[model samples]
Target: MQSLSGKTAVISGGAEGIGLALAKGLGALGMNIVLGDIEAKALARAQEIMTDLNIPHLAVEMDVSIRDDWQHTARAAQERFGDIHMLVNNAGVGGGMGALGNLDESGWRWAIDVNLMGVVYGADTFVPLMKGHGEDAWLINVASMAGMAGVPLAGSYTATKAAVVALTEAWSTELADSAIHVSVLAPAFVKTRIHQSHRNRQARYAPTTAPGPEVMKMAKGSAQAVENGIDPELLAKRVLEALDAKETYIFTHPKYRFVTDERSANIAKAFDSAAESPLVADVAEAPMALGFVDS
Candidate 1:
């Protein structure tokens, strides 16, 4: 995983934002690139950028939520650039922005389908192709800091992202013996179109309920925060560094470490409280069963 020269990478959502930045960074390192996105114009612009850089690349119109789209994208990547060494599940949507009961069903579906299920589809479609390639391989799933810490008015987005983080951890263990390494990128905030993700929302998944005033205010504040956040290019560089190091969890902003620490501390305190219960010793001595792992 140290060297990326001459490798091939497939990036979903590669037309813009963090995806495009990663494409640029990886292409600069001599990796053949396959950029996939739902936006045709943006894909064209991405291709033009790669062409200007003289980087060998391909741009494909793809909707990561659709399994058929993923299948087609996989076929295209393999046909254009032999075996795929890296798969970046970067396509995501920011939807379901409201309180639990106030959120729209469509928004929940959109977020879960794109952010969580999309990664699942990508891994299922691409991992087999990457195995035994006689070269280093990796899987990078773009999650968020919201996955680690709860953020108001972004419940569905946080839920899906947290699921992605969990999936990445599980995949890392499952693929531990294989050449394909797995990592989850949990960036706090970046100057990306994710704040305005609704601009690209599909017609069928449009929200049925309008956001409340408080929810609208929170969304605006989030967009402003993202507007003043870290540059995508810098985040891209850091991602490549993490890939080279084979780090499982990649965090972009150090300032958010305190938030994660606090979350972890709260969970530990809950465990401590549980241990103090009268039933603690009996529960501790009982055999624990993990569905995915055998003792």
Candidate 2:
């Protein structure tokens, strides 16, 4: 994982924003790039950028939510570059804004499918291939700081990202003995098009109800925050540094460190309270509930 030169990296959502920045940074390091994106126009633009840089690359129009799309992307990468050394699960969407109960089921499904399941599909499809190479590799799953500390009016998006964080932690443990290194990138707002992610919403997952007043207010504020957020290229540089350092958790925007610390401190306080409460003793003495065992 220390050396990136001559490595091959397959990055989903690589047409624009942070993904495109990552492609540029990694390509500059002499790594072969394979860009996958749902938008054909953006993919074309990304291809042009890569071409201009004289970086060997392949652009594949791919919907990360679709398993077949991932399979095709993997095959294309293998065919173009012998062994995959990096897999960047960067595709994600900003789900509908509303209270948890007020949000449409479609919104939840769309967020989970694209943000969480997309990473799962990428890892499942690529990990075996990477393992076969028997060489050092890296897997970067892009989550968000909102996942670390839940944000109001963005429950679905936060939930999906938090799940990604947990999954990456588990994968890090499971793949500890292997050459594939797993890391989750938890970044704060960046100057990306995620605020306009609704433009790419699938028809089936379209929001059924208009956002409430609070949701709309939050959306406007979030959009403003993103407009003034950190640059994507800066994030890409940090990601490359993390890879070289083999860091498990890659965070951008250190200003948000207080928020993460507050969340952790609150959880720790709750744990302390539970440890001192009589309820803990009662729960420990309670009989375990039995469940059906699959045979």
Candidate 3:
């Protein structure tokens, strides 16, 4: 997308926060905005904003966690806008908020379904559609800084985000031959409703037990952090600017680079020790002797 005008950009969770900001920004750029969200009221509000700005748009009430919902969104987008040039898998929920997860099976399932599998389903449904159009396309998956480095008391979130980063990186490489460019947005924190994500959690994903004091405290702290975080508008702006770079990894906050740098340094140090190990050399020589590996 060097020229986003007249193209279609479908964003999940586009009802509020960063998603909504992205919708507004892209809409302002003269692109057709398709807002996919689970909240009807938020969707209505978003549509109002789009209409007020005179931006061509469509609001679809759909849960990104459901595979069929993604298909529905795609069908609706195709019918309304024809070709989809951008897909932003931005729907996610904060879950298992405790060290090692103080959550039940339901909590775990909710996190994985909405955060991880949602992105997977979006890619599965939209890649072919974009490919068929024979035009350049973009896939931006929203992960967290926790994806770069584990955060204490946020095991489930960190795990899913890390998986998202891995998936996006691999897809970027695999899609290198195609015009579909993949990028993962890994931001530290933003002024979003993610801290209050429980409000929208489905009944099926309800926890068996109420949150303990520690979890409650963590939630309070998270709310504060979110309130103090960067504005979603700035994040949305960064995203649009980053799309031009066509980089595999994008970020809204560069102050958190140290976190990723420290993690990478530690992993490199550990790998160095492993490579020097006698057992590692023995396995390497065996592979070479068998001609299974290049010299």
The collision pairs in model 1 are none
Top candidate by TM-score: 1
Local accuracy of candidate 1 as per-residue lDDT tens digits, 1-295: 4668888999999999999999999999999999999999999999999999999998899889899999999899889988899999999989779876786889999998889888999999999889857567889999999898878778899999999999998899888878888999999989999998998788989888999998989999999999998999999999988877778999999889998899999999998988888877347543545425554
* Cα lDDT tens digits for candidate 3, 172-202: 8678779999999998879989988988898
Where's the lowest-lDDT run of ten residues in candidate 3? 284-293
Identify the runs in model 1 with alpha carbons over 4 angstroms from their true place.
132-134, 285-295
The per-prediction tally of clashing pairs is: 0, 0, 0
Per-residue lDDT tens digits for candidate 2, residues 174-259, read 89889999999999989999999988898889788788888888999999999998999999999988887889999988888998
Per-model RMSD to reference? 1.5, 3.6, 3.0
Would you estimate the TM-scores of all the predictions?
0.96, 0.94, 0.94
The number of the candidate with the highest lDDT is: 2
lDDT of 1 at 13: 94
Residue pairs with backbone overlap in model 2? none
Candidate 2, which ten residues in sequence have the lowest lDDT sum?
Answer: 285-294
